[model samples]
Target: MNTATPWITGVRQICLAVEDCDATIRRYYDQVGIGPWAVWTPKLTNTKIRGKTQPYSLRVAMAWTGDFMWEVVQPLEGPSIFREFLDEHGEGVHHVLVETGTEDFDQVLAEATARGLPPIMEGSWEETDFAYLQSEHALKTNIEVLRRSPIFKGRPEPDYYYPFPPPQDSPE
Candidate 1:
């Protein structure tokens, strides 16, 4: 019950900053039977690092096992919070994506800034906007909030499905 950020309704995803996303995905599947990961590299637009426009890339893999989503991100190019996290902490839990009940990312961003936990990295892909706030000092892990578009339902096809596609995606 963090009163500072009432916009956050619940935890939706837990993201791990990994050195190698595919290797980590393979290892997770081999060890814990977590597979069918959807992998993609998003073309982030209007990306900003500390209020300055700076571009970066990541190989991101996501998998859902019931209601919770797991995300692994490998920093691909340029400067990013993910890269900094790896340099400072190695591979580990970097951030948790929280569900913001509002569809307006600007409102969420404003609330976070007013709370003194400004975003270190923020960007948008298509109809979704995401912000990674600098909250490690207070919360131990960075906090990420996203405003997902209502028009978009179901997963946008990943670049590839790891280990193999799910039964629903399997070819006849």
Candidate 2:
């Protein structure tokens, strides 16, 4: 029973690495009504693979159900962990993201690495920073640390919105 501060905390987003993000979002919508999905092809900055900076791209869809978020990621360009997951596991739950606020991001990441769960991928979308940790062997899934910008709640003007976007006049 180790009470020492845990490496990861506050699981916020569950991400799936998929073959086709749009198709998955549509399936979830048609079958279960899990969406009104927001889709984006973000300009990722400072992307890294296992600590070495590199380039990669992804097609991402996000939908909020109740209090949690479901993210579907399709690797567009790779050498990324997402691509690795798909190659190995054939489209499945890839990671669970930790919602540590910006203030604690560095400290939390430092602690996680110190505890031997170092980041395999690191990148930024808009102002938000994120990292994927090597927690596969121990937790059976990768763990992500997310540092969100106060200005970004979610994509307001997404590249595409499935099941139709909300009316501009309506106050969602």
Candidate 3:
């Protein structure tokens, strides 16, 4: 953790924005043996970007590479941070996520907000609440703060899926 921000535990995950998630996963598996990959389409509700509520969906795959997890995100539908990264920078590393206790999640957000780094995206995934700080200007990529609920124990083995569920109503 940086001395400036002690709330952050450490770099938990590194996310890449990919145009083809399957191909990327396959390449990583065959070339680097990064699998087995857990692939799913995340259903993010009550989403917000720059403080305005937005609804979005993303096809994501996760695989463990030693201590840190690697994530590949393919934006499926709706406006999303992944789509924005792809549009602006094509396919590449999008963000570095840091883990924090659920108890300190709000405080981390408050500290970031106080420093004029408002979240570019904020939403919940399963039992985790995540916020992506718009830190590209200073850090060359976004910074994601994650707070995992007890239900989200740790990474599981690869499980592939198509569309997770029917789309929800778009944000107003």
- Per-residue lDDT tens digits of candidate 3, residues 11-118? 878999998999998888888766666797766766888899988888888766566788899998888889988898899999999866544777778778777667
Tens-digit per-residue lDDT, 67-163, candidate 2: 6888999999868999888888898999997765443777776777777778899999887888888889888999988777888765446798898
Q: Pick the candidate with the highest TM-score.
A: 1
State the local distance difference test value for candidate 2: 0.82
Off by over 4 Å in 2: 1-3, 101-103, 150-156, 166-172
Q: Write the per-residue lDDT of candidate 1 for residues 137-166, one digit (tens) a residue.
A: 888999998776777565567899888877
- Judging by lDDT against the true structure, name the best candidate: 1
lDDT (Cα, 0-100) at 86 in candidate 2: 85
- The total number of steric clashes, by the backbone 3 Å criterion, in model 2 comes to 0
C-alpha TM-score for every candidate: 0.90, 0.88, 0.82
